[model samples]
Target: MVALILILVGCNSGKKGEAAAEQKNPKCKVETSLFGMTPEGDSVMLYTLKNEQDITVTITNYGGIITGIYIPDKNGKTTNITLGFDNLEQYLAGHPNFGALIGRYGNRIANARFSLDGETYTLAANNGNNSLHGGVKGFDDVTWVPEVISCDERAALRLSYLSVDGEEGYPGNLSVTVTYELLMDQLFITYEAECDKATVLNLTNHAYFNLAGEGSIRDHILYI
Candidate 1:
């Protein structure tokens, strides 16, 4: 899996609309509001972080998903550069795990089972006969505890979750924290985890980027 580090260089540009008008502070700041509630009656909050560079990113406690990323181009036109839904219902309904945080195991485990310490473990076979992304209800389908970290010129949101032993057939109790930090021209995602027992873990963020804001990617070219 790739390290979830996003660098938005030269993003210091003027923006219009409510996003710009809401910038009462000239420095970095994070604000929160009710995004929605899960079927389990858990409240999910939306966090909006605006850096000094005028880049704005919206994240939800539900799955720690990135809902929007607004950055201005050289022409001073700003658009959301990420693909995601506008509300919580769409997410609960599911749509390719857009902007979600994957965990436990990122890719797939063939036959939905693995052997460790001479013992065999069976996981959820959600993807064909394999275990895909921690099973049917992975970290992406749960609520996370959010904490805001403010510095002189940067904003960060720390999302923490605890996975108990035998969750989705995974052994050991795991504690995970994923932090999204917004700097002048960069967004850093840091993942940290600790387990009481020996268990496999792989974490990553699934975020689709479109520099042109939205639409087809056939004409889009990647540098790396």
Candidate 2:
């Protein structure tokens, strides 16, 4: 089994944008609601996690996508910093991965194939001759099973999925679980996976952000 964690902390000082909606509940909590239905007739649900600091995040079961991340600025005005579409249709039609979970390989596999255990395996070449982001339908394109977990002073959403052997030509019965937690002023994303056979796996969340909230980030300086 392999475990990986990603963290996003709320900044005390940040850009300006629309104000966040006021919450009726002051304590940390998680709420569920219907987001939409897939073309295949699957029900997609949304999970909203709110913390004591007034930071709220909305995530959807479809693709484990984060629809919004509302954080307050120094002046107490809150706004969403991530870029994503409004409905499932837009996501189904496709956008640049935006706020979605990426896996079992995050980047391209050159020539749409790989050799493991001295045997060559072919993969779907979605990106020209290369297999991009696990090829054709990645983790970002699947619906995940969700469970609510309890944490001291925090709220969390755990999503799990099983990628059967030979999925997308990969040789493994892979069990993947990802957890999104709201602790204080931070949002933590933890990824865990176990494979029955030797295989390749890389996972990450694709979230496009504008720290300034709306304007171009040309003047922004990136650190690492």
Candidate 3:
């Protein structure tokens, strides 16, 4: 009847352009390998980014989480600045500080007592008696060790975790490496650590930005 309705509307526009190019290049990704479970038995490890003006960034490895950050504004359109907590029991019942990844001694060791070099340490007051970050099981609640070094290109997936010598009380044998690079437009996070027996380190990354998206972004347009 009209050439089969124009061949069924051009085969439904070529299947909607192959479903929008497989949702802009996502071909199944699910491997957090259980980073200490939470957010419903765990599942968060998806890293995909496109630049050169396409802008997209999705990083996850549990506590290596950046979750998602798509950027491109100034009339090009595409923005997702990063803010979080939608699972893991609301990030273990709230307040590990958004974007997580603040560690060892990110800010406080005061009353947790510290007298390194001569000995005299006692931690885990868990922020009140002192000792935040690395105490109460820091490293954003641990659980890392995901490597994807490369397949030749579009690489960079190395999220490490190795903390010994008194878990959070900090002593030594620490090793941390958090690198999630998606070059071209920039989404480079880098942190390297080393310790053998002289504890106390503070790392940070708690991305809570808002360009006016997600719930309660606080009236956008802030320039802080």
Candidate 4:
């Protein structure tokens, strides 16, 4: 069995700036190209990040979704180890959260409401009586602006989005950015966000992995 570790953080603060320092002799290559267009005529793009070690990941800005991940097995052969559609239509049509960046709240909120500062805020009941993943049109359903960052040792794609005040019944106008870095034998994902007002915020990357490179997880072992 393979173990996957996800780090999540939520913070409240004023505006902050971040910079990615470039490195020399970088071992990764990043490329971007047109993927498809949305019904609203918005153009979507596909980002490909490949490392010197033969690991590759493909992502799209449509939903900040990872379309595929390629890794080599013991025999020195490489294959995609994640499940996803072949094109944008399949993703736009509908599917589970498959390889998406989930937010403004990653999990469920009981009764679709939460209280803050002695005031109760109502949310969309997306799941039964609970609010799930920021309600019907969370971050996973929106397009994000993307920028490529490179360093001597790695290359990354930084995606940014702005969640307006009262969007999906959540308070505060939030500014969010998620970066996906590709390195030899590893992939690093980092998320940062700041809100203008007091609000509930949770974020996560939803990527289902099949370490064996295919089929059901019946043979995969689990921990925790």
Question: lDDT score, residue 122, model 2?
Answer: 96
Instruction: Kindly report which residue stretches of model 4 are placed more than 4 angstroms away from their true locations once superposed.
Output: 1-27
**Over all chains combined, what TM-score does candidate 4 have?**
0.88
Mind giving the per-residue lDDT tens digits that candidate 3 earns over 1-224? 00001010000111210111122223221122232355455544454545444666665566776655766677777767677754555666666477767776778778987987999888888768888766777787655766643221233455788888887567888888876655446555677889988776878777677765467765755433
Per-candidate clash tally: 0, 0, 1, 4
TM-score of 3: 0.33
lDDT of each residue in 96-121, candidate 2, tens digit only: 99999998899999998999999899
Lowest lDDT sum, 10 consecutive residues, model 3, at 1-10
Q: How many clashing residue pairs are found in candidate 3?
A: 1
Off by over 4 Å in 1: 1-26
Candidates 3 and 4 compared by lDDT, better number:
4
Q: What's the TM-score of every candidate structure?
A: 0.89, 0.88, 0.33, 0.88
Better of 2 and 3 by lDDT: 2
Worst 10 residues of 4 by lDDT: 11-20
lDDT of 4 by residue, 105-147 (tens): 9999999999998888998889999999889898999989877
Top-TM-score candidate index = 1
Q: Model 1, range 1-224, lDDT digits (tens) per residue?
A: 11258442222222211122233455677778889999999988898988777888899989989999898888888888899999999999988889999988999999999998988999988999999988999999999887776455666777889999999999999999887878777788888899999989999998888878878878977678
Name the candidate, 1 or 3, with the larger TM-score value: 1
Tell me the alpha-carbon RMSD of every candidate. 6.3, 7.7, 17.4, 4.8
Question: In candidate 3, which residue pairs clash?
Answer: 39-88
